[model samples]
Target: MSMENAIFLQKNVGFCNALKRICIEGFEYSTLYKRIEKMIADEEKKEEKNEKLLVDLWECNLLLSYQLDSKMLSICVPCLLKFALKKEEDEETPKEVEMALLSLSNIKFYRAEKELYLNEIKEIIRNHQEHHNLTRLAYQSAWQFLMNRSLVYRDLKGIVMNELHFAREVGKELEEFAKCVDWKKEKEEEMGKETKEKLVLMRWFHVLFIFFGLCNLWNEEFIGLVGGIAWVLRAAKENHKKISEKYIYLLGNAAKRRDVKVEGLLKIGVVDSVLEEIQQSTLNEGVTFQSCHFFLKISERLKEKTDNDELEEGNRKATKMEIFEKLEEEGYDDTITSYHEFLHLLKVNKIDFDAISLDISEYFVNV
Candidate 1:
């Protein structure tokens, strides 16, 4: 047989052998584990056939199967992490590294012991951003690994927020995503598949940020960042209903934060975007509620900022007046009426409609 045919036959034989082993009555998972360990360790000596064998295992679901025992996951995770973190002289990311990241992503089960490798994965995320060696898919895989773990491991949430500095990193990424797609051009003209994909990624980032924000990971520092509330609101100008609704929801959540700087909201024409959402002909009840609440909360925040003596009196007065004017221009009374209507429809007892009206009127009083 020719060399190419010989290698193909050998690969098929190995796959068949693995399947046979899995079906055997006395098969021990440890046997499969040891085989994988050996293959990974002797990859160079085996002329890289081991990488192909690993890929076959993954494709056969032998490695990627979530039904596998938790013990098996614990074993595979460390092995995969070590392989992914291996140093190499090549400038390009090796296929081995990509495969390892892919496999790690599939191994979804997490344990306290896995916390040891969290820092290592964080390194991969950072290095990939700095060096551009890992493909985008691989880099995203690394993030998936962390996000999955963070969900199951509560301790990792704070680590991901404070240690990873996700606010800054996610902000930078969203900014880069914005640059890749001309939202104005897409709205006015036609978009290619790649641009569409970028928009999808943009939504994914927004969703991810919202998730973290609800987890109490976001803070005041986010206002001025590249991917902050203002940056997200910019998408509201486009007629993408899903994006508009989601960003408005996020804005409402941010408005509730006492620490968040209300000036950031007025400076970015946030009221205009909120008005655009409120006036959507097809706006849903949920979005309408959020938009009205956003106005109420911003007014409250402006009052808080004005009351605080830390800010310069002139700047505070100017900002508070500017926001009140925008609110009046955008029909704040009409929004409050809508909010009360929603309260009645939803039977929401947590909010005091009268108090909300009073708080909003406080802003207009000072103005």
Candidate 2:
């Protein structure tokens, strides 16, 4: 069937219902699986030129990815990875590489046990990192794969941290972009025009790094994770609002982690940034929402920290009073009071916390 027909059926009857009718009522998995298998076999034949057929097979795999179960998805992984890892010869386009990576990322989501293929996926990611420019799609896909893995599999924390370090290195250009006196003005300059283009590419890289860091918020003990947060805070202080929002969301996730130390974040000026954003009268709604969210979490964390005997007596009292004084001095107390009213309005309108995250989709794209 054509893409148009498939889309029409999906829109009219719904995706899952259309899929069920096509797969269950029309063509069964056994038959479709055989057809996919034959297509893969033909693609592997040295004597044949079956690129079009292979592209069609990948498109089907992408569609199946929407609802395939673990077993069915597992059956398709090898073929998908084979296509994903294939050398880009004269005829290959970047879209093919992107599709393959997207399919692998999708299939990896449903598999119950990820251990069996984690190393292979890591290797693919490393390959992309080494040849970064040639494999932008692969690089993005690989980071996304690691992000998903980190969220679902706790044991992969060490690996995820290491990859985040790699991501920071990959995103060094963002550091340069951060240093620009004004990115908006820079974009109008001749030399800065090229930097602007690269900045667009770096957007996803920044989002992925922040997301990966968010997933590891529970592992605050890791020195790399702590250092990463500090780096993000520094960047947040200097970068444009577009980039700063990502850093704010990262801080919010870290603050919300029950195991994280409030003092450590306080020492790094996370509290100051949140307060600064909250105090800005011209702040946009998305930034204001994240600022409010981070403020609420910090308050909760501070209260919990104060109640516990983890800190030395003198230090605890001083730190707690300092934070409270800062809030009152900056009028954050009134902001919180107004935030409560805002949140009550949200509740009355049936807006949930998850919906708030979706409202700020630019910062938290895939999360």
Candidate 3:
């Protein structure tokens, strides 16, 4: 057979194979891939005819084969839908219309995921305006790949949700980054807020790396860090005790109790309990407490000691039991494990924490 005829046959075969996969072997995705691969090999074995045609055929087949496994339910979805939609418009069959609708749904799902990604992009730029370019490209590339590859799958709900969640998560990080950089705008001092913020983010990234890095994402290293954040949170709570009481008051409760003063801090309410003993101090007046939702921690103060400010030279202890109980109450243990994993979050963005709550509230209320 002449090269032209052979090439035409191969193209027809490739198209037929793809069509069969979609129409007949709908459930047999594995078969579709195997068939495509085998056909490509057969086409490659034939004698060369038109170099350009061969390349085009090879590329088209390769693209199809590559797409067989590549899932692009979010990015390439729209294009796939457009192709199907146009076909439905031309052929005008009920089956074609149904397929077009199904493809439309697939595209919509991916578009939702892409929307999530776009939201994340905006957040990255808004937060990390300084280093925004770097992350921006990363996000763009991911989205572009999503668009370029046509790998729409039947099960894409999870993919879209994950993309959205990832965007939300990454946005917080980038916003923290932006805020951290903005803090140094006026200081003109060494180790400006930018540097410290970078350190904080890097530290969190380290935790992410450790979590994602190590074979065991669930390592003890994370717990320690979470413990440390808990400790800081504890201190931050104490610092903002007075103001927290004010907010607590706003919650409109019947619990107005008292406790012994530590470091000249006049305390109110019960100790080692969910009821916060408000200590009169400056920090409290500005920031809202993280414990507003009940600050969950695994550590317990093993005999609270009086430190003028910080919890130094104090015997505070944490065990898996205490941590687990507190986290269980808050329902975070199910989502996360290990102190390091938790602490790594704080290591990333020092904001959206108690300190930031204070600053943001203060910014709006006082500043």
Q: Which has the greatest TM-score?
A: 1
The lDDT of each candidate is 0.56, 0.54, 0.33
Q: In model 2, which regions exceed 4 Å deviation?
A: 1-56, 59-65, 69-72, 86-99, 106-108, 112-116, 128-137, 149-158, 161-182, 185-247, 279-281, 305-315, 337-367
Which lDDT value does model 2 have at 327?
A: 78
lDDT of 2 by residue, 1-367 (tens): 9744643443334223222223233232556545665665667575866655654565454445345556655545555565666666555655566656654544334534665567667767666556653344355555655565556666676665556454354444334434433544554564423343333333444445545455444333333344444444455442345445656776677777766666666775668756665454355555666677887777666555344454554555666678888877765676665665667788798878565643332222111
Q: Candidate order by lDDT, highest to lowest? A: 1, 2, 3
lDDT of 3 by residue, 171-265 (tens): 34434443434433424564323343333333233222222221222123322322322222233244324323433332221111112112111
Q: How far is candidate 3 from the true structure (C-alpha RMSD, Å)?
A: 20.6
Q: Give the per-residue lDDT of model 1 (tens digit) for 144-203.
A: 667767667767766666666666666665556545556676766653233433444443
The Cα RMSD in angstroms, rounded to one decimal, for candidate 2 relative to the true structure is: 8.9
Give the TM-score of each candidate.
Answer: 0.62, 0.59, 0.21
- In model 1, where is the ten-residue run with the lowest total lDDT? 358-367
| Candidate 3 Cα lDDT to native | 0.33
- Identify the leading candidate in terms of lDDT: 1
